[model samples]
Target chain A: MLDLALKSIMRSKTRSFLTTFGIVIGITAIVALGSVSEGLRIQISEALEMAAGLIYVYEESDQPLFLAMASSSLSEEKIQEIEDVGGIKESARFVMDIAYLDGDQQFGQPDLFINGVDPENEELLVTESAELDDGETLEGGDAYSATIGYSLAQDLDIGVGDTIELKEENFVIVGVYKKIGDPGLDNGVLIPIETALDLLDTEEYSGIIVYPEDLDDVEEITDYINENIEGVTALSTEDVAITISSVIDQIQIFTFGIAGISAIVGGLGVLNTMIMSIMERKREIGIMKAVGATNNCILQQILTESVIITFFGGLAGVILGSLGAYSLRFISSALESATVTPSLAIGSLIFAVLLGLLGGFYPAWKASKLDPIEAIRYE
Target chain B: MSKTIIEVKDVKKVYNQGKPNELVVLKDIDMKVNREEMIGVFGPSGSGKSTLLHIIGCLDRPTSGKVYIEGKDVSGLTDDELALIRGQKIGFVFQQFNLIGSLTALENVEMPMRICNVEKRKAIKRAKKLLSSVGLGERINHLPSQLSGGEMQRVSLARALANEPDIILADEPTGNLDSKTGKEIINLMEELNKKGFTFVIITHDPLIAKCASRKLNIKDGKIWR
Candidate 1:
């Protein structure tokens, strides 16, 4: 029976090919859209990982969106109170200075979002593997030491051991860090928090870095700071993660919703193709049933054909979509900065297969229940 | 006394029971066939020969009355049960030959046996024997389109025998053949009948009726004496 069904399909090569193509298109569209959404999620995840150690403390009553846009400073006394919390391995408070560095001289000052950091705690938050084009990391008591991103270094034409004059203060670059894909790491300069404070000429800190002895104590210390610290909001790594995650989630939801439309259109294409195939093969189906093929047998043949076409198209689409996303990431690395991962490929392929199944149902059912006499007579 | 292989008890088939267009195609059709008895039903067009055959073959339901094949009542059987019985106990050869165009002559013959769950090796062996018996041993691998009308009918005959059916239902099996070829097919069927294969053939040709062990003349939806 299976052989007969296969032979029938082979007999109508043009029709079968056309039907398979419909499934292919559906699978491809579904996979491609899913990959885009998955790629966006990974980009956001990496961005959050880059900012893992930096806590963005805000007023407990502050609206999340408002907190995101608001720029506020923490007092030195509040920083000390946060430092006193148990599990706070260290703390540093500093203000941001928007200073541009052109090797050994100042460039037009760019609007840079900078955080004052204690030399000890700065290294903890800065990705340790972060390489620089020039200069060394700031150590407490090292006068005018700084590190810059590879992109920033390239823009300034500076390399390791080069001098960068920021806010009229000349500092020798000890270590130049290779740029991370995240926006925070790619186009910024990291100077000693005290130097940033001196440059801004303020004792107030832009934000504080609170290092926990263990990741589990992050929330506990954050809560303690929230209750005891004044004029400052306390946030842990998790709070920052949740904040960014929620925002990314909203973006992901919106994009995924848009992508879903294309996926559905693709699914409908598959359904339309399968329906036509069923219509064309009505006589063939009757012939099969006449020859003792059960409904289940017919159903299996149709489903197998559908799944096979879907699988092939889905796999191809995933590969193509990943390449597309990767190409986009490669082009934007210099500008926005990020890597597209392979998880998107796997995830989209799965969704494409599911969509294919959804698309295959009605037509397969129609084909299965056709009466032999009527079907055999169908043109 | 030969074994009674099939019995139809006053079966009536009415189309569109509740509609103004209600039509009666078969009215109280009574039929019985003994093993090895070759019967011919002669009728003009619309005499309901095909409807009677379909009811007897369990491919259709009657408006009223019962059909028995091999002594089992088939009227109340579910679709699956009817299908299983058809696959196991009956073979059909239609006026159009109805060979699956995609299958080779051997494969077409092997179809009924395969449907009966015969193993591939055994089905092929039986198909080969049947094809050879029909004098088409050399054309086993030729598809239906490659065969002449006579050859196609011979393959259909082979298929009708593939399941070792108790009876063959041939609906104008020779209608598409030339006169000479038609004679040859009737001779072949007669020879098979003599070998203890029962047959119920529906035909319009009087000459064909002359070849049967019994002749049934049908008119206006009922068998007439």
Candidate 2:
């Protein structure tokens, strides 16, 4: 019977192909969509963890959480005090301000995140946003040297040796920062910390970058800062990681919404194909039953066929979808952008196959329960 | 002197009960067939012959009345139980041959034994022997579509005999064949019957009926012995 069933399935190549096609499409959608979304979430979270200068310091204040939540500034004195904690090597006060790119393009003003730090310790706190194509680094007493992200250079139609006007002052594009594995890095701008602080014209800084002599003592130093310091919230690498994870969680909720829709569409296709296949094989089913096939046998035959289709389709979909997602990552990376991870590839494929199986179930059952005599009698 | 293998007592079949379109097909059908007996049921179209065959073959249940195969009452059995009985005791050969078109003759013949839980190697061996018994040894690898009507019927017969069933129910077995092919099929059946295989054949042809050991004519769901 098993042999016959297998042979029967193999005999109708076209029908089987059509049935498998629906399953394949469904599975592919699940795997590819899942992989790309997971990849995006990972890339974003990783970028947030590696944030160069953004800092959150803890201090003893009347309302610490409120102060952390507030858009108000942290005093330079408080920043300096936090910088004096044990294991702290050097600290730079950073001001969050935007620098509009002077360009030849016809778009609205694209403001880059221009950060401020001390000229002596600028390199300690400020990491390049993109790899330099052809450029020079910042130097003291030189008012024109500034590093710009790769995308910023492209947006402003400026490159190394080109001049970019910052706040009505023309600055030479001395260096292009390296492109990080993030989209946000594409538009960031870096300059001498003192230069930015003077340009923003504020004694109060948005945040302060703290460097610890012993990286392992970062937690203890953060705890000491919270206990002795005033008017700020301390944020360690772990805290940043948690915050990025939560942000990614929110992103996931939205991605899941899209994935959920894709799953439903795929499931519907599976159900539709199973139902149509059942209808087409009604007479054949009845004939089997009339020849002494029990209801279980009939059901098993139909269910097995459904499962087979689902399993094959799911497998194919997974391969194709993963390939697509992987290929997309390659293309993006070749253009020097973030990519989806290969680790999430399997989850999508398995999900696709499961979708096929779940979708095929009810229709297969319906096909199995059909009265054999009536089925045989059906034209 | 042969032992009775099938007994149907006062079986009834009704369609669409309690509805305006309700129709009765079989009313109190009673019959008995001994082991190795070749019994032909002759009837016109819509004469409840197929229904009788269905009940006797255990493919369907009688609305009322007991059907006993090999001395066991099967009317109250579940569909699965009926399938076991059919697989173990009853072989069916349909007018259309009913061989799965996808499978070659050998595979189709091996199907019943496989359903009966026969091991693959043994089932294949048995099927090959039966195919040869039906004079289809050379065409064992041929699909149903590739075989002639007579050859297909032979494969169908081989499939029916796969589990060594106690009774064979052939419903209009040669109705679709040419006269020469139909005669050839009837001869194959007769030879198998002589070897002690019980048969219940439903046919409209008098010549086909004449080949059986006993003849029962049916009209409007009533049987005339």
| Candidate number achieving the greatest lDDT relative to the actual structure | 2
lDDT of each: 0.71, 0.73
Estimate, for each residue in B70-90, the C-alpha lDDT of model 1 and write its tens digit.
788889987667777777778
Clashes of each: 19, 12
The alpha-carbon lDDT assigned to residue A328 of candidate 1 equals: 59
lDDT of 1 at B48: 91
Error of 1 at A335 (Å): 10
Tens-digit lDDT track of model 2 for A1-379? 5555555557667877776776676556656666655765666565655654344563434553434433447776787677777777667666656545443343543357565555565544444343456665565437656767776777677787787666666667777766555443457666666677677787777777676777777778777776677666777757766766676577667765676576567667667766876787788777666656777777676666656766777778777876766677555432232233455555555565567667767876776678877887776
Give a tens-digit lDDT track for model 1, residues A113-145.
344567765655465445544445666337577
The Cα error of candidate 1 at residue A317, in Å, is 2.0
